[model samples]
Target chain A: MISLDIDKPRAGARVVVAMSGGVDSAVTAALVAEAGYDAVGVTLQLYDDGAASARKGACCAGQDIYDARRVADALGIPHYVLDYRTRFRESVMEPFAEAYVAGETPIPCVACNRTVKFRDLLGLARDLGADALATGHYVRRLPGPDGPELHRAVDADRDQSYFLFATSRDQLDYLRFPLGGMTKDAVRREAERRALPVAAKPDSQDICFVPNGGYARAVERLRPGAAEPGDIVDLDGRRLGGHDGTIAFTVGQRRGLKVGGTGEPLYVIRTEPEARRVVVGPRAALARSEIALGGLNWLAGAEPPCRPTPVQARIRSARPPAPATLHASADGTATVALDTPEHGVAPGQACVLYDGERVLGGGWIRRAVRP
Target chain B: MSARVYLDYNASAPVWPEAADAVDEAMRAGANASSIHAPGRAARARIEDARESVARLVGADPAGIVFTGGGTEANNQAIRCSGAERVLVSAIEHESVLSADEKAEILPVDPEGVVDPEALDRALAGDARSALVAVMLANNETGVIQPVARVAEIARRRGARVHCDAVQAAGKIPVDAASLGADSYALSAHKIGGPQGVGALVLRDPDAAGRLIHGGGQERGRRAGTENVAGVVGFGRAAGIVGERLEEFARLSALRDAMEAELHAVDPEAWTVGDRAPRLPNTSMTVMPGCESAAQVIAMDLDGIAVSAGSACSSGRIRLPYVLEAMGVDEAAAMCALRVSLGWWTTPDEIDRFVASWADLRRRTARRVA
Candidate 1:
């Protein structure tokens, strides 16, 4: 009974549903079809099957593509699988490896959504003459005074707005999210009600492209000889121990330092990739009052205020939005000062801003400054 | 405008009416060809009749026909069973032939996709040991005909066996196994309006046929398992009708040319591959300067016209045409290439519609790029 807010009449409008071989997407397609709109399912084969595992660079794993085709067959909709391996490798995978090699903890999913999903796949949907592209992302798009506004999902636990912070206004206009208001349980129940075969499929875990949760191995493969042996040092530049590589550590990591003699558990304060050194210190050194952001995307109706503005910001997917002050600049850069010092702030992680539940846009973290 | 216009005949031609009827009859008879009862004899008789029809179409002896699962299996059986110490294959062959022998030395091709005759001679001359020199009668992507007769002569002089995969050339042109002088030749049904799962590997000496499947005594012990009776019957029927239609197929070159000319008129940079070489009249692989073939294919498909960017493989992904690349086409033009092949049923109106839609798509892409 969900209505897609498209211009054409429901029966005449064409909606291209991006099926990711998951139960959520399968249910989204079924629901779109049940709503009397013409639905077409498309699955992107993002990586070469020979080089990827389920958790590795394959967004649409071979089995997942088959599952999506089966779901499309059950739904009686035309389905096509486009090969996007080249685009994904260039846009998502290469940048991801580069970010890690530069000693930053990167969120590849957000970049993937920004470039491959919304940008490329949305263009393909338009090329196919579809009115809009629908996905299973648990983020709501609400009609605002000016245009469609991106918002957090009704199910706070499953909200994916943090990953979709880079969706441009043009792309937002042509995208629809049907599961934005529904809970995960309700989606699984709907799948069961529709008799979809993937109803019992487990949720995809970790990064989709890191095989067996081995992100370090994935990075090493992408960048050969990137993990050279380096020095693990303390806050005063005293060598505590030797480590395999600076890439093996991230900001705020506390375990596996191998420096057992340190009185308190030493956490990684920062990593200097060029120097090949990981600087460790006491836990308090991990907290940062402000972080500079680059590649800022503004989703607010108006231009970003040049003056410092009060807002809630989320630095990572798991953390809730916190009180922060945003200072926008002429160049595409901004700095956010949190009301309370935040921990584990690392470069390359996204800093998404919000006004209550509505996303005002975000950017990649450039640097985290200690108080 | 919404009615689908299919122009990808080189990928798989539409099944002919008679072939369809033969398949339906075979399926309805419900008698296994291996059984010994009267109904089984009737099924066997149908298969034998089809074998003769296919043999006559290709100018080969009926006794040499060994039907396999499809074209890939046929090519594999021919090369794997040749008992040769080494393999020499052309760079422009279908994946079925190129991937058959992993260690096979690849013979290079010219700019028009024709195999270098001198290269083959050198390969055969250098390796005195007996080898299987495999080459296709025609390139699948570019439709460029190969000098199979001369290459086979060189191989024969050097005591190397030759295999001509005539899957793309058999029905498109005159394919005479004896004239080509190949020890073994492969043919597929689907490329010539027959059922998809049936193909034949014709051997000059029947005793040389190698068995890839070894279960049943079917295919005269040359292949195993029960015959795909319906598929074989359809292939036979398709072969029986294709001979008389060869002249008509040759005339389709005009349609393909007109389509190319119209494309050139729309985009001055449009160029055709293998135009200087003796190619199949039905195929035209054209490249427009700035248009990506994948985008063109999608745009054409949306307009209800079916074409392909390269050889349509099992994965349904459009790869840069290795055939074009081997022919010395640069990556930019290769990425922009689209293969628009015509068939016996392809009408003039369909070609016009495709040209119009393609020109519009080109303009749209150009504007977007600007």
Candidate 2:
């Protein structure tokens, strides 16, 4: 039986806390320091922007590092700024742009957490001789029969397990999520209790790379000639109108269609980048009963059941995980059949599966099929 | 390591032997310069002698120089003293200047970071009655020297005082306070082989009253508290050495030229900031397309070379150089710029090592991207 001690841990257990200059991470670092861990805060310098650096609310770049350093100084811990621009661009931004150009709605936060935060940052922590790598991600880890099992946060509203399903078991071993048990409000309260500088700092909503909420613009910047003008076609293959680029539209999107329909709202069912066309249809056509996933990574020791294994799958981060049956293939692919058809299941999105609260790993949705 | 090639001179250079010796001598004296006794008088003489040396190096009257903790403090003191209700500063000014006032208007620069004199004149001519103009003599990022004299003349005609943060320019160039004709000038000792914590702010008028630190009567009642005697002595010694070796050290300009040419050869689109403008001979700010400055700095460090992205004071903070932004370079390209500044200790072998390291880094970066 595991001992549960509510008291704060003793001080001076060397740990490296990844402080992203956000309220969550700032509070995490402060709590770790208060708990008697020799917490050394590190902020990844991911990009350069002179004007943006001087401006408020720009983190993960120059000014953010300064803010992190300031917080570290206030907390009386050693702070370091690591330059992870190349790694972040390759592992997060580049892939995000490429996926969009390939007619998919890519979620960059998953890639960032997987590659840059987990892999590269963990390697740095090891080099620094840190015992553990801590972040402010709201996910819990509990000792299970096999090893440490990843669990959903107690605060269901802010649980980030969906974005972190790709984290390997080995990576999880060295990781610590300090804000797992607390609600967002509690975290904010703790931040205020510690008198942390970013106590009421607003949460970052848009993609970090696409700072201006223009993911399409970021794609166009990366691949200048890739997003050519395309056609907005109906499900019957009739070109209804023209679109500047098929890359701008995502699966199940309803905005910017500019296609006049018979009063009923038309939604995007598909985006064909190769043909530069967006296929629009009725909202009912957006529902998908089954989704094929590729590049599957199962957090469990073995592959999920070759036959249907009952689980809960969430196609996107915001959506709740719906009851589904996951069928694993021999070649590391999986098919997830939802009990109730879900809407707007897009390719290139992560299909994270959960068994109760335990994250069972996930994969990118390759294709969504209607019943 | 092969002598640890020190390309981070802009961060802080090694204390010149003379400066170190002076510091040691002052430390040995063990007397407070403020005391009225004989020992105090002796210490006071040493402090004054050092002050004279520092003043001479920057072509300012000794009485006009007020020693401070360092460049940052000096910049803050000088900029905050401009006594203007509204401050007009070049976008490329150091963080000290940039953060002095949130409401300060930032004057734009061209692609080469040359501040348009007409733009300054127009800004000063506006409704800002108590506006103070602040522009650095040389940008810490690109080493791109601004047309301070032109800007100063414009500010003077408009009855505005000009403050130049000459920390990067003092030792690297022939800095004459009288020539620039700015109301106040800021310089850091460490940027010129002096002690890390000692710097001086020179006011064109000795009686210009603006005090950031208010306490005891020191620095001619302009600044407060006791002086850092050892550090001030080191600054004096370094300043004297810099003044004597000005012409000889200017030869580092050739090394900078060679490095710029080699970098451009490797990537034709790779740009050197202020290439056409007059700049510090030892500074090179190069932008390689698709290469991040922070990554290149890391790669250089792995190769046993120490370089900086822009100003070491603001190195880890990822931001485009304000100078570049004012020049209208897009944010993406600006983010990829790396600044390599040479110093008195730099040798040809080190420059060659840098070239080879950069070439290897380019190949590795390309491979990784592919």
Candidate 3:
């Protein structure tokens, strides 16, 4: 029986599965339908697939939509594709461009999951009279003493808990993640077992809207002339070299600096967008012991402004969570004191707080504190 | 669990049982229309019979009727093969017409969703000699009827060719190509309870233009490719059935009005777009205040009803509500509106069910947000 921690039994309970034209979501839908639930598959058209693929002529349905429709037909479940272009451009794409211009390393996927996917799509699922909204994300929701708790996936390497730290408690209560307990390989096998069409499909990589992996090009197109000419400077403000623009660089980056012959291997310290300057230094100058965060979402159900508490802090999705002390404030902000110095922490990244595999909650990085 | 009530007739209506039987019989008796054998001659006769029926539906010369793949191809052929240097279409035309030529000029509309006649006149004053003016008889989103006769008069008086896309209004209303004074017009079959993948374009001079497809001598050299004998037969049968019962649309309009009134009674803030304008009898664009149209559509579908939104196509792609936006409706309000189109198969019980379920949804979502 696939109760899914939902209030109702598996039979006749409606579940809306967010299908992304991928294998993981396909398996998720397969599992729900096999358990005798009325599963409805919903795919969001986040961008103009026609423009992205440059397909010409009278065709409106894209290949991704076609694939999703095929999977739905194979699974014998009803499917829908909702247009979210305007919503996505407003909530995710615009913020991504502005954050890049402000010299921050923005995580667009996180913004997508937090706003359009979780907040808006969840509302649609509820309106559709669905008992719950399920996704293929590798995160778990277990019944805790207080209520449902957001925890890490069973497969640590494929865990996506970092990107979903901004989910509110109310949203989580109506959500289900079926792939959290399985590894990627096991997911592929399960998909094959269920005879899913996308079982052999490769995983999607990089940013979805950014074509050809061209970040600077995408930013320049979004905000014309965003990559203005600027000067490269050392920590002491000594001019090193002239560059095309700061949009092409991020904190802790070593490539494309053009100042390769500096004594030790040079790393980007930070970008001053207002000054049109790129600051570079040795690797040691990039170390930060404290980080400030804003727009906090706390799932621990505890009020803020509490005393500094010990927890694991993850600054980037690529890095593992590290030992740290969390000092939360009442005004949707928090500061994390790392027990050991970490390198290359950038603004606009998330500092997710975790307590041994359980996600307490997290916020966006505002600035790195110098120790 | 219950019988599904399909209200998305504008997308594609349920095929009539007679048309289905015609198609099934045609498939059993297989022969190419182009062949010279007795079976082939029988197939050719069937196609000619279909052509006459399609021609009568639009009051066109039977010889001027040209069959194509579907409404989209008919539209592309009208605008692109009309031998006009400049193409101008209304802002509310279907995607097929609007995207036919990248440089085609777009004419605007008023808040009532009608094309501005004065604006059309001013636009064609200088280049009407080389222009092809295209407008839809009715909008697919709001079902607002355009002043096609007036537009055709302006375009023809100024020496410009006129084209009309009657895809949405053909079977629902009385449509005669000559009455509207259009040089050419295109319409679909499935919209009138016919088979998909088939449509016809009524041309003023069929022999003067035929460049859309060019491999075969079928369709009187106006279009190319072997004839879909079964599809054409089904279309002819459906057209005959739709033509005899155009009077029933008045009753559908009454049902639609009653449902809208009941819906407004439940939620006073809801909007009925283009209600004050001359519109199709069975089409309604209902806007639920503070609710997303996608959500409303999904909710209704779960309750065994089918509706739509301009923002989401039948194929499930998310599109901008450009039709409503062209009428000065804000994007926020436009996204909150859904399209409900009734057809020949709609029942009074279905309308009652829709009203009841829609009211239940309003009650469910009426809570205030923080």
Which candidate leads the pack in DockQ?
A: 3
- TM-scores computed on chain B for all candidates: 0.98, 0.96, 0.97
- Superposition TM-score, candidate 2 onto the true structure: 0.63
Worst 10 residues of 2 chain A by lDDT: A1-10
Instruction: Assess every candidate by TM-score.
Output: 0.94, 0.63, 0.94
Off by over 4 Å in 2: A1-111, A114-371, B126-130, B313-315
Measured against the true two-chain complex, the DockQ scores of the candidates, in the order shown, are 0.39, 0.08, 0.54
Residues B1-370, candidate 3: write the lDDT tens digits: 5898888899898999999999898878889999999999989888899988988888888888888888999999998887788898999999889988888999999998999978989999976359899999999989999999999999988888888999988878998888899988888999899999999888877675647888888887888899999999989898888888889975799989988998899889898999999999999998888787877888888888998886244476546688999999988888789899998989989988888888877776775231
Clashing pairs in 3: A83-B318
Candidate 2 vs 3: which has more lDDT? 3
Share of native C-alpha contacts between chains A and B (below 8 angstroms) recovered by candidate 1: 0.23
Question: Which 10 consecutive residues of model 1 chain A have the lowest summed lDDT?
Answer: A51-60
Each candidate's interface RMSD (Å, one decimal) is 4.2, 6.8, 2.8
- Candidate 3 lDDT tens digits, A268-348: 999999999999999999999999999998887855448889999999998899999999988999899999988979998
Candidate 2 lDDT by residue in tens digits, B150-249? 9999988988889999998897889899989898899999888988988988988999958899999898898897888889999998999988888877
Per prediction, fnat is: 0.23, 0.09, 0.60
